[model samples]
Target: MQNETTKIALLVAIATLIFLLVPVFLILYIRSYNRHKKNHFLEKQNMQQKFESEMLQTRVEVQDQTMQSIATELHDNVGQLLSLTTLTLNSVNVNDEEKARKKIDNSLALVNKSIKELRELAKLLHGEQLVESGIGHAIDQEINWLNKAGTYELKVNNHLVDLQITSPDKDLIILRLLQEIINNIIKHAQAKQIHIDTYLEKNKLHLKVADNGIGFDPNEMKMKKSGMGLNSIYKRIEMINGKLVLNSAPGEGTSISIEIPYP
Candidate 1:
């Protein structure tokens, strides 16, 4: 009887051990699952944070570009025109009434022109609003300013003017990209002709800028890291999952084509 009792107690002890271990194993499993969930949440949160940060940086860069363009216009175009007007007025002489009259009339004409240019500059001051109007309008405004220089023969075809969709973020990036391209052209291309085409097809936006400029080998430029503007273009394009193709050769014109998915 004592042996039988001993066996029963031993069996009970084994069963109790297993029962206690079952709860411990279950607790461990639950903890592991919770940890995985937490890690996944953190990863997603990090990605969102990174995206926001990039977007903010892009906005600031765009604003800076706009301000720079404004400064250039004020100094190179408007300021020069006003200065000429002033000079013409200062040279006026009462004794030579005929010449003085002509000078006054010329100054009047220049003042009118300056006023018009100032109005355009005002539109540009609202750069963000220009983007709000639509990417097409914003592009047209930039092209108009470029045309004012009368340095380049511009041929443009923009079909997204009546686009019903809007993507503000992408629009800003696109505008900045165009600004950078134009800056590069003005600073280095020495081109007399520029052709720009923009349209949307298959839910993809396409922009092409071709210039009759003194082109250089793109591979050499990339190797030399001399095209800082090109580098910036690539970085911004990649951020938006866009693609860019550049074609150029020495003595040949340069053409840049960009494709991006649209809303």
Candidate 2:
């Protein structure tokens, strides 16, 4: 009888211990979960901050590029036009009616051209708003500017102009990417023939730019860590989960193809 009583006491003690441990385990599990949740929230917030910072940088770069173009146009084209108009007017003689009439006509035409050029510059003032309509239109506008330079034989086929949906952040990043690529080409490609193509397929946006310019080995440049532009391109691509394929050789021209997720 004493042994049975002792066994019952032991069993009760074991049950009580287990009952106590279950709540302890539960509390520990809840605390661990809460910690994990907090950490996750912090990580997400950090990513958001990083994205906003990148956006700001991209915006500033775009504005800087616009301002540079405006300055160049003012000095090289409009300033020259206005200066020529001034010269033409100064040469006019009041005593020679017919000659003066011709000079006046020429000055009027020059002034009109200046006005048209200024109007175009006014449109460029909206460079930041270029992507508001759609990326397709924005890219076309860039191409139009390049065409104006008459520096290359350009072949462009852009189908994104009619795209119905948009992702604002992605659109801006993509436009900046294109701008960077074009700048690299203009600065280094030394190519007379350039081609650009963009389209949407299977929920992916595709961009391909090729030029018949002097090209360098991609692997060599990457090994040397010499291409800041290339590094920037890779970083931006990673941020947006895009893919890049670049082909180049010493004598062969360069081709860059990019694929990005779309809305």
Candidate 3:
């Protein structure tokens, strides 16, 4: 009878030990899982901070580019108009009534033209405001500036002008991307004709630019990493979770297409 009692006590003690250890092991497992979650949260937060920082930098660069464009327009365009108006007014003979009147009329016409150009400049100056209205209008404004040069035979089909959705950050990046591409053409492409198409479909925005320029080898460019502008374009696109497609060959033309998710 004493031996049976000893066996019972031993079994009870073992069971009690298991019961106590179970909670301890469960708590350890939960603590490990919680730690993993905390680390993941910190990683995601860091990524978000980095993204916002890059976006702010992008905005500053865009503003700088806009100011440069405004300065160019003032120097090359509006300044010339004002200068011509001055010349016309100075050439007038105050004594010759008819001649003076004619000169005065010409000056007035030039002044009106200058005013019109200034109004357009004002629109360009409000780059951020343009984005606020909608990305489509902002895009139209950019194209208008490019069209002013009349260097390329441009075929523009922009359907985004009436788009209802807006993504402010992405809009600026998109504009910068287009500007970079156009700058590349002006500097190196030597293309005679350029076509730009933009539209929205299936909750995605698409932009396409094609040039009849002397194209280069894409593989070679990637290997060299000398295409700084192209690299920047790729980085910006990736940041926005967008896709870029390029098609070009040695003697053939070049075409680039970008698709981005919309808000």
Most accurate candidate by lDDT: 3
TM-score of candidate 3 on Cα atoms, chains taken together: 0.91
Off by over 4 Å in 1: 1-33, 95-100, 221-226
Please give the range of 10 consecutive residues that has the lowest summed lDDT in model 3: 223-232
Per-residue lDDT of 1-263 in model 3, one digit per residue for the tens?
A: 99999999999999999999999999999999999999999999998998898789888977888898899999999999999999999999989999999999999999999999999999988998998899889889988998998788999999999998898989988888888898888887889999999999999999999999999898888988867389889988999999999999987989999999986
TM-score of each: 0.80, 0.92, 0.91
- Show where candidate 3 strays beyond 4 Å: 1-17
Q: Return the lDDT, model 2, position 242.
A: 94
Residue-level lDDT of model 1, residues 156-257, one tens digit each, is: 999988988879889988998998899999999989999999999999999999999999899998997757478888988897899999999988989999
lDDT of each: 0.90, 0.90, 0.91
Question: Judged by lDDT against the true structure, how good is candidate 2?
Answer: 0.90
Question: What are the C-alpha RMSDs, in order, of all predicted structures?
Answer: 4.0, 1.8, 2.3
Residue pairs in steric clash, candidate 3? none
State the TM-score for model 2. Answer: 0.92
Runs in model 2 deviating more than 4 A are 1-10, 226-228
- Using TM-score as the measure, which candidate wins? 2
Per-residue error for 17 in candidate 3, Å, reads 5.5
Give Cα distance to truth, residue 108, candidate 1, Å. 2.0
